[model samples]
Target: MADDRRLEVLSAIVTDYVRTREPVGSRALVERYRLGVSPATIRNDMAALEDEGYIHQPHTSAGRVPTEKGYRLFVDEVARIRPLSAPERAAISALLTGAVDLEQVVLRTVRVLAQLTGQLAVVEYPSLRLTSLRHLELVALAPARLLMVIITDTGRVEQRTITLMGDRPDPGDDGAHGVIDPVALERLKIRLNASLVGRRADDVAPALAGLAEQAPSDERALLAAVTGELIAALRPDAEERIAVAGTANLARATPDFTTMGPLLDAIEEQVVLLRLLSGDPADASGMRVSIGSENHEDALAEASVVTAGYGPGVGDAVAHLGIIGPTRMDYPATMAAVRAVARYLSRFLAGPQD
Candidate 1:
């Protein structure tokens, strides 16, 4: 019973401090919250909480503020995540409307999340190796050049320009450019669609090689060029990239954080950003919070990260999205906003049926 009362006092202290941005005294707590206790009892609870490292007196003042431990406890045991209202959900879905492709969807998602959370938002693109091919378009440009468009089921599009290394074709498209044989292009398209349309990008060279071996001699060179470019697009990204928005919000909230410069720099570094944003449902909470020193990067020691993974289906994460802000943030509201935005983004990327 005593422990529960202490927890209630701790929760009240955290709430008041987060709201008023001031240290909470026992007198303030009794006045602001219905603790059902006298000032003496509240002060005793505060002393016990401070002794347990949950709350601390900043400068010999009687008023106390929650420590990181206190905030973690509040999140884990006390605070209830506020649900996104119907109007808020409608607004997020509306923001992502008319995005023609997955990349556009992700871009708009970051923007919406930034606006919603009022913090720096970052999103990782899904891995190309994990997505199956949806469509491949090979267009002959000029006599010796071909344009390759690779589309994935995840709505990512990759384009590459390849110059056919060995093929020599006459300029025949109305004197505009030498067009590869229409018959050859169509046959290659059929072969590629059959071999690639529903397959993951892994071990793709062998499949394309088999096609090249069986190609008619006249189309062999063009097929090889097309195959090579497609393979390049399929290779895993050497450096993972992320889209970021609302950096201006960081500067605006700088006063709340002591490590603002390093935090900003960390946000800009691809490797650092990836390390911070990457989370799995197996290892992280549904809506995870990495607060203060919980962030592995030293530069972000005074910052907090809120992240959730979104994918093509339930619980299978294809990508991660989240916000970064000071540890003194309103945790429940931010978590709700991140989760809500992620749900809409997953629907957008999951295609019409999702």
Candidate 2:
């Protein structure tokens, strides 16, 4: 019973401190919350919490504020991370559903997240290597020019324009004009799909290595150009990309940070943000929270990050999204916003594309 009451006092301190950005005294806690106990008893509980390293008094005469330990305990024990309200869910769904492609979806998602949490938001784009090819379309724009459309299972689409080169004109074309035969273009499309559809992005190039050789002599040059572009599109060294929003929100919490320069610089470095978001594995609730000193970067020492992975299903995270703010943040609401947005994004990616 004593332990439980102490936890309650700690929770109340965390809440009041986060809201007011001020040290909470036992008297204020008693008045603000009905602890069902006398002021002296609350003071004793506060003393116990402080001794245990969960909270501390910054100034000898001032009231108490929660330490990082206290915040972690509050997040793990006392905070109830509830789902977003029906209207909130509807709003997110409506916003995400309107996106036309993968790029738009990511941009819109980061904006929505930043708005919901009032904090800096980061979203890692789905890794191409993890996605399978869903469809491939080839259109003959002209005899020497073709449009190649590649669609992935995660609804990512890439288009490339290939210019045919070599000594041969298409089968039905006069030597004067570099026109491709319609019948041959259609046949190449069918063959390319047969050889490459459903393969992982990393395997695309290898699967198409001998494809040009298999085509008829007159069509080999066109096939080779198309395959080369496809291979380049799915190169292994392709840099991973991330989207970020709400830097102004960080500026609002300037008082909480020791120095804002390093933090701001780190945010601009995509590689740093990606490593931070993906470093920690999530907990049972599909959430990962890094508080204060737990963060790897010196720039983030005074900040907290809440992240959740999103993908087609459980244990299949293709990428992650999260928020960064001062350690004195509202953990419950931030966790809920991250979880909710991640769920919506997962459903969006798993669904069929237009």
Candidate 3:
């Protein structure tokens, strides 16, 4: 019975400390929670919890705050993470309703998520290597410039611009009329799409090579020129990127001038921020909650990360989305928001292309 009451006391302390951002006293716990106990019993429970290292006093005369271990226990056992309310779901849906394309959807999602979570939201762009090509478009914008648009089955659209030598003549033309021919462009689009559709980014170059080799005399050079640009655009190293928003939220939440530099610096570094999210192929459907020092990044030692994986395909495919905030944040609420946003993103990606 004593152990049960002590755990209850510890839970109250953690909850109050997270909400108030101050060490909670026995009297405060008694006033805030109906624990059905006397103030003397609550004080004794607080003393026992402090002795066991679950809660610690910040100063000689102050009350107690929960340690990382205490927060972990509260998160894993005591705290109940509830789902988003109907109004929140409607708000999220209303915010994301009219995005024009997948890129716009991904771009808006991070910002909407940041607003929803009230933390720095980061979302990794879906991996090109893992997605199959759905379509490809090439349009000549100038005598020598062409825009190439690549669309993938996972609703990701990537684009690149290429240049052709203006002085070169068509292979079948008798004159050096270097300007692009619309008829030739249409033929190239059809030829490229036949080979590229359903092919992954990594396998695209070889497929392009095979198609170019089997091409007719007048089309080989055009095919090779277009394929070169497509190969470069499809390189995973060149196109790997992420979306981030809500830096102002971090600035607003931070009060200590000493922590401002490292925290803001971590948010600005793309590689550092990308490594902070734990979702990948293996953790495609799981969540990673790294609290304080658990993140292993020295700058992030004073913060916590709540990441959840979101899938864009029907199979075992996914990308990561989550937020960063102070270690004393409300875990259950933040985790629930992250999870709800991830679910919404998955539905959007799985639904339709546009």
Candidate 4:
């Protein structure tokens, strides 16, 4: 019972600190919260918490503020994450369902997250490595060019143009010119789809290599060129894209100018943001909270990152979406916002449900 009461006092302190951005005093806690204890008792609890490194007095005679340990305990043990209201849920669905393409979806998502949480939002584009080929289309654009469209299960589309000239000259054409035969093109399309559809991006190149070697002697060169384009389209370098919004929100949340510049610069660096979001390889379809010094990045030591994975299901996170803000954030609300947005995004990317 003593431990539970101390936890309650700590929770109250965190709540008051976040709302007022001020150190919480024992008298304030006794007056504002129904702790059923005297101010002296509360002070004793505060002293014990400070000794345990959960709360600290910033000045010699000031009230107590929560330490990182205190915040972590509040997030893990004390805070209750309430479900978003009906109106909030409706707003999320309406905004996201209207996106016409992947780019728009990501753009709108970052905006919505920023607006909803009043914090910097970062979203990693769905990684092709985690998605399987949904479909592949081959359209002849000209006598020597073909437009190849690659669609993934995560609603990502990549298009590449392939030149088939010099691979095989048409029967009636000179050696310098060639035209793709419709019948051969259709056959190659079927073969390529049969070999690649439903395969992950990492497995695509190997599968295409086999298909190219097995093609008819006249079609082998054409198949090889098409496969080469497909491989390039799914290269790893193209999968590292992310969208960010609400940098200004950080300024509003953080009053300390000393750390704000470096924090803003770190946010501008995509590599640092990606590393921050992707740090937990073992985190699949769960909310991850990295608070204060726990973030490891020097610039982010004064910030907290709340992230959630979005995708088809557990163990299959296509990517991640998260918020970055000052460590003194409202953990419950921020966590709920991140979680709700991630769920809606996962459902949308999974397409129409049966």
Say which candidate scores most in TM-score.
4
lDDT of 4 by residue, 184-257 (tens): 77888888889888999889988987886677755665677787888777788764789999988988976733
- Candidate 1 lDDT by residue in tens digits, 1-354: 248899899889988988887889988988889989899999999989999999999877669988888888887788777998888788788888887877788888899888888889998887677778889888877667778888877787777888865435433322222346666777788888898788887857778888876776666667767876777777776445589999998898876776577777777788888778874232344678887788877888878888988878788667788999887788888988988887887787787771
Q: How well is each residue in 107-189 modelled by candidate 2, as lDDT tens digits?
A: 99999999999999999988777778888998988767889998887877778888766465556543333456677778888
Candidate ranking under TM-score, highest first, comes to: 4, 1, 3, 2
Q: So what's the TM-score on candidate 3? A: 0.85
Q: In candidate 4, which residue pairs clash?
A: none
Please state every model's RMSD to the true fold in angstroms: 4.0, 3.9, 3.6, 3.0
Q: Which of 3 and 4 is ahead in lDDT?
A: 4
Kindly provide the TM-score of model 4 when superposed on the true structure, using C-alpha atoms.
0.90
lDDT of every predicted structure (CA atoms) = 0.80, 0.86, 0.78, 0.84
**TM-score of each model, paired residue for residue:** 0.88, 0.85, 0.85, 0.90
Candidate 4: list runs displaced more than 4 Å: 140-145, 163-183, 281-285
Count residue pairs with overlapping backbones in model 2: 1
Arranged by lDDT with the best first, the candidates are 2, 4, 1, 3
| Candidate 3: tens digits of C-alpha lDDT, residues 33-67 | 99999999898888887887888998998999988
